[model samples]
Each structure stands twice: as structure tokens, then as C-alpha cells.
Target: MMKNIQLKAMGKINLGLDVVRRRPDGYHEVRMVMQTVSLYDKVGITVEDQPGIRITANLSFLPLNENNIVYKAAKLLMDEFSIDQGVSISLEKHIPVAGGMAGGSTDGAAVLYGMNRLFSLGMGQKRLMELGLKLGADVPYCIMRGTALAEGIGEVLTPMPPMPDCWILIARPPFGVSTRFVYENLHLEKIDRHPDIDGIVRAIEDSDLEAMCARLENVLETVTIRKHPQIEEIKNFMRERGAVNALMSGSGPTVFGIFENERECRSAAEAVRERGMARQVYAVKPFNP
Candidate 1:
């Protein structure tokens, strides 16, 4: 078995997110197209002499115990496989926590994937995805990594085509958004429009950047933007600054713009930084690998 392995926990952005309806289980039935982006967290997994999982993170505020998804993933793998071997995991956080970036979910997926290789567990992708589902709804998609249409509380995934060629400019304000609160406050009557998923899919198939941008929408934005006007302000700023399309991702305070070129994307990121519109800014591309 390899003594140590490092994995990238990629982040995601929702091109379109719509709540279909409220389910009986208290979870909303959702239809959203989620895409992996270049922003990521680096996680290191190492074999240890002890007989349990130990987790440490560079971020001071993050819990290294069971509260962390990485710890939970390691524990789940050990228990499921009946392995006695101990493991130590360290997280170098790059993606913003609780910023609608799927940071925690991807970290959990990375652990499961890295451990499968580190311990030589011989678990295949299907089994890994199955196990990932137990950790979080987004974990399965993170393990798969790419463009996907996620439905049924974000667990049901159907692989979609690669996104159009463009740069993704992301900006997250210095504020936290509670996914639970956003979901709880979402009233279907208040939503005037839901995203056109089929239209976006057609645009993707045609590689039409403008059409894809035109169809960009998220129902969650109605609730999130109402609570934080800055989210909308950032969108307008990006749209005016050479971004063909802009929208908030997931239950966000993080708004991303789809820029046609690298120069414009970089300029927009720097401008957002200089204008104090965002706490964190990134100019990145879709993560195909």
C-alpha cells in the first residue's frame, strides 16, 4: 500500500438549479446542472500506526473531528471494509467553506477515492459512488467529476456533455449562507421563473456559448439574492465587465461569470478584488480532468 497520496477535491458551480417541488421526506426535489470547476482543495492521506482515523486541517476554524466530512468518510470506509489499518488525513482548504462550493462534499469524495488507492481496497467507481451517497448528496457527483444533471435532492445524476469553451470567474463575498435556511425559506409561489434545463442542454450540445449564457438561471437565486442584494450587484458588475453571462451558484453568496476570454476573466477578477465586491476571487476553467 502507498504510504501517502494527495488528491484534489474539485469545486462545483450550478449552471442551473430549480426546485421541482417539496418532497414528503422534507427534502426538495431538485433539477440542476452541476459542473466541476478548476478551484479545488488539496487533501493528503497517509497510513498511520494507530487503529483509527485522525484528521487535521490548515483552516483554523474547521473541525478535525467527526464534524468534518473527511473524518466521516475515512471512518465509513474503515467500518465498511473491516480494515484495522489506521489513517491520517490532512486538508489544505482552497475552496471556501459553506460558500455553496461543495467544498466539504468534494473533500469527503477525495478521501474515499484516495483511500481506495492508498489501502489497495480494490473498490470500483460504482461502489465508491454508492458509498459517497451516504456521506452527502453532492459526494457521488464529486467522485464522478464532470458535467452532470443532478436531481432528486441532488443525488440522482445523469452525465452531461462538456461545457462550452470559456473562462469561469468566481467571486464569493465575506458572508456565509446557510443551505438549510435558503431551502426552508424558498416559497414556490415567490419564484417567477425556473431555469430552462432543456434549452441549456441544447446549447451545450451545440457548443453555443451565448445560448448557454442566455439560459443560465438558478431558482435558489431568488431566495439568496433577496437576502443578500450584493449577490445581484456582483452579477450586474460582472455582466457589465465583459462577462457574457453571470449567476449565483447553488444557495450562494458566490456569484460566477462566464467570460469568453482569459484577459477579460482575469481583469474581472482583479476588478472585483479592487472594488471589494468579493472576499475571494478566482478566474478558472471547467475541470474536465
Candidate 2:
């Protein structure tokens, strides 16, 4: 029987994000605290007798050929090892596309990790991460698979200690935000207040939920919220509905409400859904690697 493997590619949420400066490469220098969440896309990989890659997803809008990140990951591996075997990848996308959740990057990371195991490629995590960096800035963190403090275009990661047990309510509006455009439009001079990165890191170490909530800040929030008032409305709704900390994740149209417990998280999610303020709402725990 051909080797088959299935992997879960979890989505990411930026607890705090700051754009430091613009680089010569035109990519913004950033400092972000990113956490993986239980919400994920399921990727099923199966070796094929045929000699080319095949990718299928329930979402017809996604690209299935070489342009797909999954396909690119597989192709990168094949080229590196000169392997003859082909693979088929099927993605069940649960994460919102282009919602600043890093769905595509997560899928790419899953492909690299799954293929490494399924094909016995013997590629170390370091190598895989290196390859992942070429695919996307967020891919490295996905491969790392845990809470992390990311810097320098989001490739530099320092693994954060596990967070306190909590539930998360994530809501995304019907539209998607373009990360590239958000960065392009960002006005650096107007960004007078900076997130207290050191303070937030310390709070995580201490497991001080209140301190973390107080420190929760995203510079991109200004840009995103200004363009899409719905994001701000969702954030306000979540806060009123009992979220301890509510913020927009990534360059998002998706806003997350962090709760101290599952009951509050579920209640808030239900309330938000009933209010019809969001297209989708997910109740999930923070992913721990």
C-alpha cells in the first residue's frame, strides 16, 4: 500500500503586532507575538503511482496546481532530493482565506512536515523551516508549531512558554483583508504608541492574564480598523459580550475574543453569532505546538 498521512494545519492569531520599519526589500520589519489555535485545516497526503503532483480541496476557489503553497512545498522537497514519487494533497480548509490567519502558510508548513514523515525524507526541522521561509514569512512559525514571539519579517521566532488554559472566540466578517495592501498603506509616523513587547513577554512567563490583556496591542489594528469599521464593531461587541481581551488578529477582518474559560468563550461566540455581526465564529483553544 502507498504511504498516506494526514496532518492538521492550525491557524495563527497575533496577540500583539508592531510594525517597526520598512526594509529595503519592501517587507515591513515587525515584532509580533503569534499563537497557534485549535482551528485548523485538515490536509490528507497520499503517494501516487503517477509522476506528478495532484492537489484537491473542497474550496474550489483555492489554486490546486503549482501555485498552491502545498504544491510548492512538495515541489521544493522533490527538487531537493530528486525524488521520483508523486503525491496527492487534499485540503479541508476551515480557516478563513486571506483573513490574516495564515491559512495558506499553515497548509504549506503541514505539507513540508507531512511529506518529510511520509516520504522519510530525513529533513530536519531546521531545514524544513529554512525551506518554509522561502514559501512565506508565517510558514516558519507554523512549522515551529507553538506560541512564539516573531520578529524581522516574522521569520525570527522565540518559542513562548505555554499559555494559561483559556478559550478563544474568533469571528471573521465576509470579506478578506490584503496583508500587502495593509502594510503598504500603513503610516509609520502616525504610529506614536508602541506595544510593550518586553512587558507582554514577562506577563506570559508569569501567566498573568490581566497583564497580557492590558498589553494586547496591534499597530496594524489602526490601519485595518480604519478601513473596515466592521472589525472595530466586532471587537467592541466581543468586549461587551465578556471577552477579557479582544483584538484583530494579523492584518485582519477577523477579530478574536479571549476568555478566561470555555463557558465564557462559548457563550460569547453564540452571542456574536446570534447578533449576526460576523459571517463565522469559532470557539477554540490555543494550540500548543
TM match of model 2 to true structure:
0.98
Q: What is the C-alpha lDDT of each candidate?
A: 0.92, 0.90
Structure candidate 1, residue pairs in collision: none
Where is model 1 more than 4 Å wrong at Cα?
none
C-alpha root-mean-square deviation, each candidate: 0.8, 1.1
**Clash number for candidate 1:** 0
Put down candidate 1 lDDT per residue, 250-274, tens digits, no spaces: 8998899999999999999999999
Q: How far is candidate 2 from the true structure (C-alpha RMSD, Å)?
A: 1.1
**Candidate 2 pairs with clashing backbones:** 145-289
TM-score of each: 0.98, 0.98
Q: CA shift at 185, candidate 1, in angstroms? A: 0.2
